[model samples]
Target: MKWAIAMVDGILNVLKPSGMTSHDVIGYLRRVLQTKKIGHSGTLDPDAAGVLPVFIGAATRLLEYSGEETKSYRVELRFGVKTDTADDSGNVIETSVVFRPEQEKLVAVLKKFTGPMMQIPPMYSAVRHEGKKLYQLARAGITIERESRPITIYKLDLVYQADDYLVLDIECSKGTFIRTLCEDIAESLGMCGTVSFLLRTRSGKFVLNDAKTLEEISKAPFDHILPIEGAVEHFPELMLTDKQALRISQGVVTSISGVAEGKYRLKTASGLFIGIGSANNGMVKADKVINPFTQM
Candidate 1:
Protein backbone atom coordinates (compact mmCIF):
# COMPACT_ATOMS: atom_id res chain seq x y z
CA MET A 1 0.00 0.00 0.00
CA LYS A 2 1.19 3.50 -0.83
CA TRP A 3 0.42 6.64 1.23
CA ALA A 4 0.86 10.10 -0.21
CA ILE A 5 2.63 12.60 1.95
CA ALA A 6 0.13 14.87 3.74
CA MET A 7 0.08 18.50 2.60
CA VAL A 8 0.00 19.72 6.17
CA ASP A 9 0.39 18.33 9.68
CA GLY A 10 -1.19 20.51 12.34
CA ILE A 11 -4.53 21.69 13.73
CA LEU A 12 -7.31 23.72 12.13
CA ASN A 13 -9.54 25.77 14.39
CA VAL A 14 -12.79 25.31 12.51
CA LEU A 15 -15.97 27.14 13.37
CA LYS A 16 -18.39 24.30 12.86
CA PRO A 17 -21.77 25.49 11.69
CA SER A 18 -25.00 24.23 13.17
CA GLY A 19 -26.91 21.46 11.36
CA MET A 20 -23.64 19.69 10.55
CA THR A 21 -22.23 16.74 12.45
CA SER A 22 -18.61 16.75 13.61
CA HIS A 23 -17.92 13.88 11.20
CA ASP A 24 -19.36 16.05 8.46
CA VAL A 25 -16.57 18.56 9.02
CA ILE A 26 -14.01 15.76 8.95
CA GLY A 27 -15.41 14.52 5.65
CA TYR A 28 -15.34 18.01 4.20
CA LEU A 29 -11.72 18.50 5.22
CA ARG A 30 -10.83 15.08 3.84
CA ARG A 31 -12.08 16.22 0.45
CA VAL A 32 -10.32 19.57 0.73
CA LEU A 33 -7.01 18.29 2.06
CA GLN A 34 -7.10 15.00 0.17
CA THR A 35 -6.08 13.00 3.22
CA LYS A 36 -7.73 10.71 5.75
CA LYS A 37 -5.37 11.32 8.65
CA ILE A 38 -7.68 13.77 10.40
CA GLY A 39 -9.72 13.77 13.60
CA HIS A 40 -11.55 16.20 15.90
CA SER A 41 -10.69 16.79 19.51
CA GLY A 42 -14.29 16.76 20.69
CA THR A 43 -17.81 16.15 19.46
CA LEU A 44 -20.14 19.13 19.26
CA ASP A 45 -23.81 18.39 18.78
CA PRO A 46 -25.18 19.13 15.34
CA ASP A 47 -27.46 21.78 16.79
CA ALA A 48 -24.55 23.55 18.46
CA ALA A 49 -21.98 25.73 16.73
CA GLY A 50 -18.54 27.04 17.66
CA VAL A 51 -14.84 26.38 18.01
CA LEU A 52 -13.89 22.86 16.88
CA PRO A 53 -10.22 21.94 16.71
CA VAL A 54 -9.57 19.60 13.80
CA PHE A 55 -6.25 17.76 13.86
CA ILE A 56 -4.40 16.84 10.69
CA GLY A 57 -1.59 14.34 10.19
CA ALA A 58 0.67 13.92 13.20
CA ALA A 59 -1.41 16.41 15.19
CA THR A 60 -4.09 13.72 15.53
CA ARG A 61 -1.97 12.05 18.19
CA LEU A 62 -2.46 15.03 20.48
CA LEU A 63 -6.25 14.61 20.61
CA GLU A 64 -6.22 12.43 23.73
CA TYR A 65 -4.47 15.14 25.72
CA SER A 66 -6.19 18.15 24.14
CA GLY A 67 -9.65 16.57 24.38
CA GLU A 68 -9.28 16.38 28.13
CA GLU A 69 -8.73 20.12 28.44
CA THR A 70 -11.49 22.40 29.78
CA LYS A 71 -14.16 23.80 27.46
CA SER A 72 -16.28 26.92 27.69
CA TYR A 73 -19.67 27.68 26.19
CA ARG A 74 -22.38 30.28 25.91
CA VAL A 75 -25.72 28.57 26.23
CA GLU A 76 -29.31 29.74 26.01
CA LEU A 77 -32.01 27.93 27.96
CA ARG A 78 -35.74 28.15 27.34
CA PHE A 79 -37.80 27.52 30.43
CA GLY A 80 -41.26 25.91 30.63
CA VAL A 81 -40.36 23.21 28.13
CA LYS A 82 -38.83 19.76 28.38
CA THR A 83 -37.52 17.66 25.53
CA ASP A 84 -36.39 14.08 25.33
CA THR A 85 -33.08 15.19 23.87
CA ALA A 86 -32.94 18.16 26.25
CA ASP A 87 -32.46 20.48 23.29
CA ASP A 88 -34.68 22.13 20.69
CA SER A 89 -33.75 19.40 18.23
CA GLY A 90 -35.65 16.82 20.25
CA ASN A 91 -39.39 16.24 20.53
CA VAL A 92 -41.14 18.19 23.17
CA ILE A 93 -42.14 15.81 25.91
CA GLU A 94 -43.73 18.35 28.27
CA THR A 95 -44.61 22.02 28.49
CA SER A 96 -45.71 24.41 31.18
CA VAL A 97 -46.89 28.00 31.54
CA VAL A 98 -43.70 30.06 31.42
CA PHE A 99 -42.85 31.98 34.55
CA ARG A 100 -39.79 34.04 35.25
CA PRO A 101 -38.02 33.46 38.54
CA GLU A 102 -36.35 36.15 40.61
CA GLN A 103 -32.78 37.01 39.60
CA GLU A 104 -31.52 36.11 43.06
CA LYS A 105 -33.22 32.72 42.94
CA LEU A 106 -31.81 31.99 39.51
CA VAL A 107 -28.33 32.92 40.65
CA ALA A 108 -28.64 30.67 43.68
CA VAL A 109 -29.75 27.75 41.54
CA LEU A 110 -26.90 28.28 39.08
CA LYS A 111 -24.38 28.35 41.90
CA LYS A 112 -25.49 24.98 43.14
CA PHE A 113 -24.50 23.39 39.81
CA THR A 114 -20.91 24.62 40.01
CA GLY A 115 -18.05 22.32 41.06
CA PRO A 116 -18.29 18.52 40.74
CA MET A 117 -21.55 16.72 40.01
CA MET A 118 -22.87 13.58 38.41
CA GLN A 119 -24.60 14.14 35.05
CA ILE A 120 -26.84 11.68 33.28
CA PRO A 121 -26.11 11.30 29.59
CA PRO A 122 -29.17 12.17 27.53
CA MET A 123 -30.90 9.43 25.54
CA TYR A 124 -30.51 11.48 22.36
CA SER A 125 -26.73 11.58 22.83
CA ALA A 126 -23.96 9.58 21.15
CA VAL A 127 -23.08 7.74 24.33
CA ARG A 128 -22.94 4.00 23.79
CA HIS A 129 -25.13 1.72 25.83
CA GLU A 130 -24.81 -2.06 25.64
CA GLY A 131 -22.93 -1.92 22.35
CA LYS A 132 -25.40 0.54 20.79
CA LYS A 133 -25.50 4.30 20.54
CA LEU A 134 -28.05 5.88 22.87
CA TYR A 135 -29.43 8.06 20.09
CA GLN A 136 -29.95 5.03 17.85
CA LEU A 137 -31.92 3.27 20.58
CA ALA A 138 -33.87 6.49 21.22
CA ARG A 139 -34.95 6.73 17.58
CA ALA A 140 -36.17 3.13 17.84
CA GLY A 141 -38.32 4.12 20.82
CA ILE A 142 -36.13 2.30 23.28
CA THR A 143 -34.87 3.82 26.50
CA ILE A 144 -32.27 2.31 28.81
CA GLU A 145 -30.93 3.28 32.17
CA ARG A 146 -27.54 4.97 32.07
CA GLU A 147 -25.18 5.38 34.95
CA SER A 148 -24.44 8.95 35.99
CA ARG A 149 -20.87 10.06 35.37
CA PRO A 150 -18.87 12.53 37.40
CA ILE A 151 -18.35 15.89 35.66
CA THR A 152 -17.14 19.23 36.86
CA ILE A 153 -18.66 22.62 36.12
CA TYR A 154 -15.81 24.97 36.77
CA LYS A 155 -18.03 28.02 36.36
CA LEU A 156 -21.70 28.59 35.58
CA ASP A 157 -22.74 32.23 35.39
CA LEU A 158 -26.10 33.64 34.45
CA VAL A 159 -25.16 36.07 31.77
CA TYR A 160 -28.62 37.35 30.90
CA GLN A 161 -32.23 36.66 31.84
CA ALA A 162 -35.64 37.41 30.45
CA ASP A 163 -39.20 36.30 31.05
CA ASP A 164 -38.84 32.77 29.67
CA TYR A 165 -35.23 32.53 28.49
CA LEU A 166 -31.82 32.90 30.08
CA VAL A 167 -28.27 32.99 28.79
CA LEU A 168 -25.45 31.32 30.66
CA ASP A 169 -21.69 31.28 30.34
CA ILE A 170 -20.28 27.92 31.31
CA GLU A 171 -16.75 26.64 31.83
CA CYS A 172 -16.68 22.91 32.40
CA SER A 173 -14.54 19.83 32.27
CA LYS A 174 -14.74 17.20 29.56
CA GLY A 175 -17.79 14.87 29.33
CA THR A 176 -20.18 17.57 30.55
CA PHE A 177 -23.54 17.77 28.80
CA ILE A 178 -24.76 21.37 28.73
CA ARG A 179 -28.25 20.21 27.87
CA THR A 180 -28.39 18.05 30.98
CA LEU A 181 -27.04 20.92 33.05
CA CYS A 182 -29.76 23.23 31.76
CA GLU A 183 -32.46 20.69 32.54
CA ASP A 184 -31.10 20.21 36.05
CA ILE A 185 -31.05 23.95 36.57
CA ALA A 186 -34.66 24.31 35.50
CA GLU A 187 -35.69 21.42 37.73
CA SER A 188 -34.00 23.08 40.64
CA LEU A 189 -35.89 26.29 39.85
CA GLY A 190 -39.18 24.35 39.94
CA MET A 191 -39.68 24.56 36.16
CA CYS A 192 -38.75 22.70 33.01
CA GLY A 193 -36.23 23.86 30.44
CA THR A 194 -34.31 22.86 27.34
CA VAL A 195 -31.29 24.22 25.54
CA SER A 196 -32.47 26.63 22.86
CA PHE A 197 -28.98 27.50 21.61
CA LEU A 198 -25.40 26.52 22.36
CA LEU A 199 -22.15 28.11 21.19
CA ARG A 200 -18.83 26.86 22.36
CA THR A 201 -16.61 29.84 23.11
CA ARG A 202 -13.45 27.89 23.84
CA SER A 203 -12.01 24.39 23.70
CA GLY A 204 -8.79 24.30 25.66
CA LYS A 205 -6.67 27.14 24.27
CA PHE A 206 -8.63 27.43 21.00
CA VAL A 207 -11.28 30.15 20.97
CA LEU A 208 -14.19 30.92 18.68
CA ASN A 209 -12.65 34.24 17.63
CA ASP A 210 -9.67 32.39 16.15
CA ALA A 211 -11.75 29.73 14.38
CA LYS A 212 -12.19 29.72 10.63
CA THR A 213 -15.49 29.06 8.91
CA LEU A 214 -15.65 26.47 6.15
CA GLU A 215 -15.67 29.20 3.53
CA GLU A 216 -12.69 30.94 5.10
CA ILE A 217 -10.80 27.68 5.31
CA SER A 218 -11.43 27.07 1.64
CA LYS A 219 -9.96 30.43 0.69
CA ALA A 220 -7.21 30.51 3.31
CA PRO A 221 -3.63 29.43 2.73
CA PHE A 222 -2.66 25.93 3.79
CA ASP A 223 -0.22 27.56 6.20
CA HIS A 224 -3.23 28.54 8.34
CA ILE A 225 -2.71 25.19 10.02
CA LEU A 226 -0.93 25.56 13.38
CA PRO A 227 2.03 23.43 14.30
CA ILE A 228 1.34 20.22 16.24
CA GLU A 229 3.36 21.53 19.17
CA GLY A 230 0.82 24.31 19.73
CA ALA A 231 -1.79 21.74 20.64
CA VAL A 232 0.19 20.52 23.66
CA GLU A 233 1.72 23.82 24.75
CA HIS A 234 0.01 23.48 28.11
CA PHE A 235 2.31 20.62 29.05
CA PRO A 236 5.75 21.26 30.45
CA GLU A 237 8.49 21.01 27.86
CA LEU A 238 11.63 18.84 28.13
CA MET A 239 14.29 19.80 25.59
CA LEU A 240 16.64 16.95 24.78
CA THR A 241 20.03 16.70 23.06
CA ASP A 242 20.18 15.18 19.59
CA LYS A 243 21.34 11.86 21.02
CA GLN A 244 18.66 11.87 23.70
CA ALA A 245 15.98 12.91 21.23
CA LEU A 246 16.99 10.10 18.90
CA ARG A 247 16.76 7.60 21.73
CA ILE A 248 13.34 8.85 22.79
CA SER A 249 12.16 8.78 19.19
CA GLN A 250 13.10 5.11 19.19
CA GLY A 251 10.87 4.54 22.26
CA VAL A 252 13.76 4.23 24.67
CA VAL A 253 13.67 5.33 28.31
CA THR A 254 16.08 8.15 29.16
CA SER A 255 17.00 10.10 32.28
CA ILE A 256 15.47 13.58 32.61
CA SER A 257 15.73 16.17 35.33
CA GLY A 258 14.10 19.29 36.75
CA VAL A 259 10.57 18.26 35.81
CA ALA A 260 7.72 17.11 37.99
CA GLU A 261 6.03 13.73 37.64
CA GLY A 262 3.69 14.23 34.69
CA LYS A 263 3.54 14.42 30.95
CA TYR A 264 5.98 16.73 29.12
CA ARG A 265 6.18 17.78 25.53
CA LEU A 266 9.32 16.15 24.14
CA LYS A 267 11.32 18.47 21.95
CA THR A 268 14.80 18.58 20.48
CA ALA A 269 17.34 21.00 21.95
CA SER A 270 16.63 23.11 18.89
CA GLY A 271 12.94 23.18 19.96
CA LEU A 272 11.43 20.84 17.40
CA PHE A 273 8.60 18.91 19.05
CA ILE A 274 9.31 15.17 18.80
CA GLY A 275 6.34 13.85 20.79
CA ILE A 276 5.21 13.30 24.35
CA GLY A 277 7.07 11.79 27.31
CA SER A 278 6.33 10.90 30.90
CA ALA A 279 8.61 12.09 33.70
CA ASN A 280 8.46 10.21 36.95
CA ASN A 281 11.08 9.64 39.65
CA GLY A 282 13.70 11.47 37.54
CA MET A 283 13.23 9.06 34.60
CA VAL A 284 11.59 9.95 31.29
CA LYS A 285 10.02 7.42 28.92
CA ALA A 286 8.36 7.94 25.59
CA ASP A 287 4.59 7.97 25.83
CA LYS A 288 4.04 8.60 22.12
CA VAL A 289 7.08 9.38 20.06
CA ILE A 290 6.63 10.94 16.67
CA ASN A 291 8.74 9.77 13.75
CA PRO A 292 10.93 12.81 13.35
CA PHE A 293 11.76 11.80 9.81
CA THR A 294 8.11 11.66 8.76
CA GLN A 295 6.45 14.24 11.01
CA MET A 296 6.17 17.88 9.97
Candidate 2:
Protein backbone atom coordinates (compact mmCIF):
# COMPACT_ATOMS: atom_id res chain seq x y z
CA MET A 1 0.00 0.00 0.00
CA LYS A 2 1.29 3.47 -0.90
CA TRP A 3 0.59 6.49 1.24
CA ALA A 4 -0.82 9.44 -0.64
CA ILE A 5 1.67 12.22 -1.34
CA ALA A 6 0.02 15.55 -0.62
CA MET A 7 0.53 18.88 1.09
CA VAL A 8 0.59 17.95 4.78
CA ASP A 9 -0.53 20.63 7.22
CA GLY A 10 -0.20 20.77 11.03
CA ILE A 11 2.58 20.19 13.56
CA LEU A 12 4.62 17.11 14.48
CA ASN A 13 5.78 16.53 18.08
CA VAL A 14 8.89 14.79 16.84
CA LEU A 15 11.00 12.87 19.37
CA LYS A 16 14.38 13.59 17.81
CA PRO A 17 17.02 10.95 18.35
CA SER A 18 20.58 11.77 19.32
CA GLY A 19 23.04 12.28 16.46
CA MET A 20 20.46 13.98 14.22
CA THR A 21 20.14 17.73 13.69
CA SER A 22 16.70 19.35 13.86
CA HIS A 23 17.09 20.24 10.18
CA ASP A 24 17.75 16.57 9.45
CA VAL A 25 14.29 15.73 10.83
CA ILE A 26 12.72 18.46 8.69
CA GLY A 27 14.56 17.10 5.66
CA TYR A 28 13.37 13.56 6.41
CA LEU A 29 9.77 14.69 6.84
CA ARG A 30 9.90 16.65 3.60
CA ARG A 31 10.56 13.33 1.86
CA VAL A 32 8.14 11.32 3.99
CA LEU A 33 5.35 13.85 3.52
CA GLN A 34 6.56 14.86 0.05
CA THR A 35 6.43 18.63 0.59
CA LYS A 36 8.93 21.42 1.00
CA LYS A 37 6.84 23.74 3.19
CA ILE A 38 8.16 22.45 6.49
CA GLY A 39 9.85 24.24 9.40
CA HIS A 40 10.58 23.78 13.13
CA SER A 41 9.85 25.97 16.15
CA GLY A 42 13.32 25.51 17.64
CA THR A 43 16.65 23.93 16.72
CA LEU A 44 18.19 21.13 18.80
CA ASP A 45 21.87 20.43 18.61
CA PRO A 46 22.84 17.28 16.73
CA ASP A 47 24.05 15.69 19.99
CA ALA A 48 20.85 16.56 21.88
CA ALA A 49 17.62 14.60 21.69
CA GLY A 50 13.91 14.96 22.51
CA VAL A 51 10.77 16.89 21.63
CA LEU A 52 11.11 18.98 18.44
CA PRO A 53 7.85 20.56 17.26
CA VAL A 54 7.82 20.61 13.43
CA PHE A 55 5.54 22.81 11.36
CA ILE A 56 4.26 21.65 8.00
CA GLY A 57 2.32 23.22 5.12
CA ALA A 58 0.23 26.24 6.13
CA ALA A 59 1.18 25.69 9.77
CA THR A 60 4.65 26.95 8.85
CA ARG A 61 3.18 30.44 8.83
CA LEU A 62 2.17 30.03 12.49
CA LEU A 63 5.65 29.21 13.75
CA GLU A 64 6.17 32.66 15.23
CA TYR A 65 2.88 32.49 17.12
CA SER A 66 3.67 29.24 18.90
CA GLY A 67 3.61 29.48 22.70
CA GLU A 68 6.44 26.94 22.82
CA GLU A 69 9.08 29.60 23.32
CA THR A 70 9.92 28.43 26.85
CA LYS A 71 11.64 25.05 27.01
CA SER A 72 12.47 22.36 29.60
CA TYR A 73 15.32 19.90 29.59
CA ARG A 74 16.78 17.02 31.54
CA VAL A 75 20.48 17.76 31.57
CA GLU A 76 23.66 16.26 33.03
CA LEU A 77 26.78 18.14 33.95
CA ARG A 78 30.06 16.33 34.49
CA PHE A 79 32.39 18.18 36.83
CA GLY A 80 36.18 18.44 36.88
CA VAL A 81 36.45 19.14 33.15
CA LYS A 82 35.84 22.16 30.92
CA THR A 83 35.34 21.94 27.17
CA ASP A 84 35.69 24.54 24.46
CA THR A 85 32.04 23.98 23.40
CA ALA A 86 30.86 23.93 27.05
CA ASP A 87 29.68 20.37 26.31
CA ASP A 88 31.40 16.98 26.31
CA SER A 89 31.42 17.12 22.51
CA GLY A 90 34.11 19.80 22.49
CA ASN A 91 37.82 19.57 23.08
CA VAL A 92 38.87 19.54 26.73
CA ILE A 93 40.18 22.99 27.44
CA GLU A 94 40.60 22.70 31.21
CA THR A 95 40.46 20.03 33.90
CA SER A 96 40.98 20.18 37.63
CA VAL A 97 40.90 18.17 40.79
CA VAL A 98 37.50 18.87 42.28
CA PHE A 99 35.01 17.90 44.96
CA ARG A 100 31.26 17.99 44.71
CA PRO A 101 29.49 20.48 46.92
CA GLU A 102 27.04 19.40 49.61
CA GLN A 103 23.42 19.03 48.52
CA GLU A 104 22.42 22.17 50.47
CA LYS A 105 25.13 24.26 48.81
CA LEU A 106 24.28 22.85 45.41
CA VAL A 107 20.60 23.67 45.84
CA ALA A 108 21.38 27.22 46.92
CA VAL A 109 23.67 27.74 43.94
CA LEU A 110 21.00 26.45 41.59
CA LYS A 111 18.60 28.95 43.11
CA LYS A 112 20.93 31.80 42.20
CA PHE A 113 20.59 30.77 38.55
CA THR A 114 16.83 30.70 38.76
CA GLY A 115 14.58 33.65 37.96
CA PRO A 116 16.31 36.18 35.65
CA MET A 117 20.01 36.54 34.87
CA MET A 118 22.37 37.57 32.11
CA GLN A 119 24.01 34.86 29.99
CA ILE A 120 26.66 35.05 27.31
CA PRO A 121 25.70 32.88 24.35
CA PRO A 122 28.27 30.18 23.78
CA MET A 123 30.75 30.58 20.93
CA TYR A 124 29.37 27.37 19.41
CA SER A 125 25.83 28.72 19.18
CA ALA A 126 24.00 29.99 16.07
CA VAL A 127 23.87 33.57 17.41
CA ARG A 128 25.26 35.92 14.80
CA HIS A 129 28.22 38.22 15.40
CA GLU A 130 28.44 40.79 12.60
CA GLY A 131 27.18 38.88 9.49
CA LYS A 132 28.40 35.37 10.33
CA LYS A 133 27.11 32.81 12.79
CA LEU A 134 29.10 32.41 16.02
CA TYR A 135 29.39 28.71 15.41
CA GLN A 136 30.73 29.40 11.92
CA LEU A 137 33.40 31.62 13.41
CA ALA A 138 34.18 29.05 16.11
CA ARG A 139 34.71 26.42 13.43
CA ALA A 140 37.29 28.64 11.80
CA GLY A 141 39.20 29.13 15.14
CA ILE A 142 37.82 32.60 15.88
CA THR A 143 36.15 33.80 19.07
CA ILE A 144 34.67 37.23 19.66
CA GLU A 145 33.05 39.04 22.54
CA ARG A 146 29.29 38.51 22.76
CA GLU A 147 26.84 40.57 24.74
CA SER A 148 25.02 38.77 27.53
CA ARG A 149 21.27 38.41 27.08
CA PRO A 150 18.69 38.11 29.81
CA ILE A 151 17.20 34.62 30.36
CA THR A 152 14.98 33.20 33.02
CA ILE A 153 15.39 29.79 34.57
CA TYR A 154 11.87 29.22 35.76
CA LYS A 155 12.77 25.98 37.50
CA LEU A 156 16.05 24.26 38.26
CA ASP A 157 15.95 21.14 40.40
CA LEU A 158 18.72 18.72 41.10
CA VAL A 159 17.51 15.25 40.22
CA TYR A 160 20.67 13.40 41.26
CA GLN A 161 24.33 13.90 42.02
CA ALA A 162 27.27 11.54 41.79
CA ASP A 163 30.96 11.86 42.48
CA ASP A 164 31.70 13.53 39.18
CA TYR A 165 28.36 14.35 37.57
CA LEU A 166 24.95 15.71 38.43
CA VAL A 167 21.54 15.54 36.79
CA LEU A 168 19.20 18.52 36.67
CA ASP A 169 15.72 19.27 35.42
CA ILE A 170 15.58 22.82 34.09
CA GLU A 171 12.68 24.88 32.74
CA CYS A 172 13.88 28.09 31.16
CA SER A 173 12.95 30.80 28.72
CA LYS A 174 14.15 30.82 25.12
CA GLY A 175 17.89 31.46 24.45
CA THR A 176 18.95 29.85 27.73
CA PHE A 177 21.84 27.53 26.88
CA ILE A 178 22.01 24.46 29.14
CA ARG A 179 25.67 23.96 28.33
CA THR A 180 26.49 27.48 29.46
CA LEU A 181 24.21 27.14 32.45
CA CYS A 182 25.98 23.95 33.44
CA GLU A 183 29.36 25.63 33.27
CA ASP A 184 28.17 28.62 35.22
CA ILE A 185 26.63 26.50 37.94
CA ALA A 186 29.83 24.50 38.25
CA GLU A 187 31.86 27.69 38.38
CA SER A 188 29.81 28.99 41.28
CA LEU A 189 30.61 25.74 43.10
CA GLY A 190 34.36 26.14 42.46
CA MET A 191 34.73 23.49 39.75
CA CYS A 192 34.98 23.23 35.97
CA GLY A 193 32.26 21.37 34.15
CA THR A 194 30.72 20.46 30.79
CA VAL A 195 27.25 19.33 29.77
CA SER A 196 27.66 15.59 29.32
CA PHE A 197 24.09 14.86 28.27
CA LEU A 198 20.89 16.69 27.33
CA LEU A 199 17.30 15.57 26.73
CA ARG A 200 14.63 18.18 26.10
CA THR A 201 11.55 17.11 28.00
CA ARG A 202 9.26 19.95 27.04
CA SER A 203 8.87 22.83 24.63
CA GLY A 204 5.87 24.67 26.08
CA LYS A 205 2.87 22.39 25.32
CA PHE A 206 4.87 19.71 23.49
CA VAL A 207 6.14 17.08 25.92
CA LEU A 208 8.29 13.96 25.80
CA ASN A 209 5.39 11.52 26.28
CA ASP A 210 3.50 12.96 23.32
CA ALA A 211 6.51 13.12 21.01
CA LYS A 212 6.55 10.55 18.16
CA THR A 213 9.70 8.77 17.13
CA LEU A 214 10.87 8.80 13.53
CA GLU A 215 9.97 5.11 13.20
CA GLU A 216 6.45 5.76 14.45
CA ILE A 217 6.04 8.75 12.13
CA SER A 218 7.32 6.70 9.19
CA LYS A 219 4.66 4.06 9.76
CA ALA A 220 1.63 6.36 10.13
CA PRO A 221 2.72 9.91 9.51
CA PHE A 222 -0.65 11.60 9.36
CA ASP A 223 -1.71 10.24 12.72
CA HIS A 224 1.08 12.23 14.33
CA ILE A 225 0.22 15.57 12.74
CA LEU A 226 -0.94 17.94 15.48
CA PRO A 227 -3.55 20.46 14.37
CA ILE A 228 -2.12 23.89 13.57
CA GLU A 229 -4.46 25.55 16.06
CA GLY A 230 -2.72 23.61 18.81
CA ALA A 231 0.25 25.87 18.24
CA VAL A 232 -1.70 28.89 19.50
CA GLU A 233 -4.14 27.18 21.89
CA HIS A 234 -2.87 29.47 24.62
CA PHE A 235 -4.26 32.52 22.81
CA PRO A 236 -7.82 33.72 23.34
CA GLU A 237 -10.39 32.91 20.66
CA LEU A 238 -12.93 35.02 18.80
CA MET A 239 -15.91 33.45 17.03
CA LEU A 240 -16.66 35.24 13.78
CA THR A 241 -19.66 35.43 11.47
CA ASP A 242 -19.33 34.05 7.94
CA LYS A 243 -19.11 37.54 6.54
CA GLN A 244 -16.62 38.60 9.22
CA ALA A 245 -14.46 35.55 8.60
CA LEU A 246 -14.49 36.25 4.89
CA ARG A 247 -13.48 39.83 5.50
CA ILE A 248 -10.64 38.87 7.85
CA SER A 249 -9.45 36.17 5.45
CA GLN A 250 -9.09 38.79 2.77
CA GLY A 251 -6.59 40.78 4.91
CA VAL A 252 -9.11 43.40 6.01
CA VAL A 253 -9.12 44.67 9.58
CA THR A 254 -12.67 43.87 10.61
CA SER A 255 -14.42 45.82 13.33
CA ILE A 256 -14.74 44.02 16.62
CA SER A 257 -16.46 44.89 19.92
CA GLY A 258 -16.13 43.79 23.57
CA VAL A 259 -12.87 41.92 22.75
CA ALA A 260 -9.94 43.37 24.61
CA GLU A 261 -6.87 44.56 22.70
CA GLY A 262 -4.80 41.39 22.16
CA LYS A 263 -4.10 38.55 19.76
CA TYR A 264 -6.69 35.83 19.18
CA ARG A 265 -7.32 32.52 17.50
CA LEU A 266 -9.90 33.33 14.84
CA LYS A 267 -12.64 30.84 14.08
CA THR A 268 -15.54 31.06 11.69
CA ALA A 269 -19.16 30.55 12.77
CA SER A 270 -18.83 27.03 11.37
CA GLY A 271 -15.90 26.44 13.77
CA LEU A 272 -13.08 26.45 11.21
CA PHE A 273 -9.82 27.82 12.59
CA ILE A 274 -8.83 30.33 9.92
CA GLY A 275 -5.75 31.88 11.50
CA ILE A 276 -4.44 34.30 14.09
CA GLY A 277 -5.32 37.99 14.39
CA SER A 278 -4.67 40.97 16.67
CA ALA A 279 -7.28 43.30 18.11
CA ASN A 280 -6.89 46.98 18.88
CA ASN A 281 -9.25 49.97 19.24
CA GLY A 282 -12.30 47.98 18.09
CA MET A 283 -10.56 46.35 15.12
CA VAL A 284 -8.88 43.03 14.51
CA LYS A 285 -6.46 42.29 11.66
CA ALA A 286 -5.29 38.89 10.55
CA ASP A 287 -1.57 38.48 11.20
CA LYS A 288 -1.30 34.95 9.88
CA VAL A 289 -3.75 33.04 7.70
CA ILE A 290 -3.89 29.47 6.49
CA ASN A 291 -2.77 29.87 2.92
CA PRO A 292 -5.31 28.16 0.61
CA PHE A 293 -2.59 26.64 -1.55
CA THR A 294 -1.62 24.40 1.38
CA GLN A 295 -5.03 22.71 1.63
CA MET A 296 -4.84 19.05 0.65
State model 1's lDDT: 0.88
Please count the clashing residue pairs in each candidate, in the order shown: 0, 0
Who wins the TM-score comparison?
A: 1
User: Candidate 2, which ten residues in sequence have the lowest lDDT sum?
Assistant: 287-296
Scored against the true structure, residue 163 in model 2 reaches a CA lDDT of 88
Model 2: clashing residue pairs? none
Candidate 2, residue 108: how far the Cα is off, in Å: 1.2
> Mind giving the per-residue lDDT tens digits that candidate 2 earns over 1-296?
34444556899999999999888998898878877788998788889999999998888888887644689999999999999999878999999778979988988999899999999999999888788989999999998999999999999998998989899999999888899999999999999999989999999789999999999999997988988888888798899887788888888888988889999999876678988889999899988887321221
What is the Å distance of residue 259 in model 1 from its true position? 3.0
For each candidate, what TM-score against the reference?
A: 0.95, 0.93
Inter-residue clash pairs, candidate 1: none
Question: What is the TM-score of candidate 2?
Answer: 0.93
C-alpha local distance difference test of each model: 0.88, 0.88
lDDT of 1 by residue, 34-59 (tens): 78899998899999999999999988
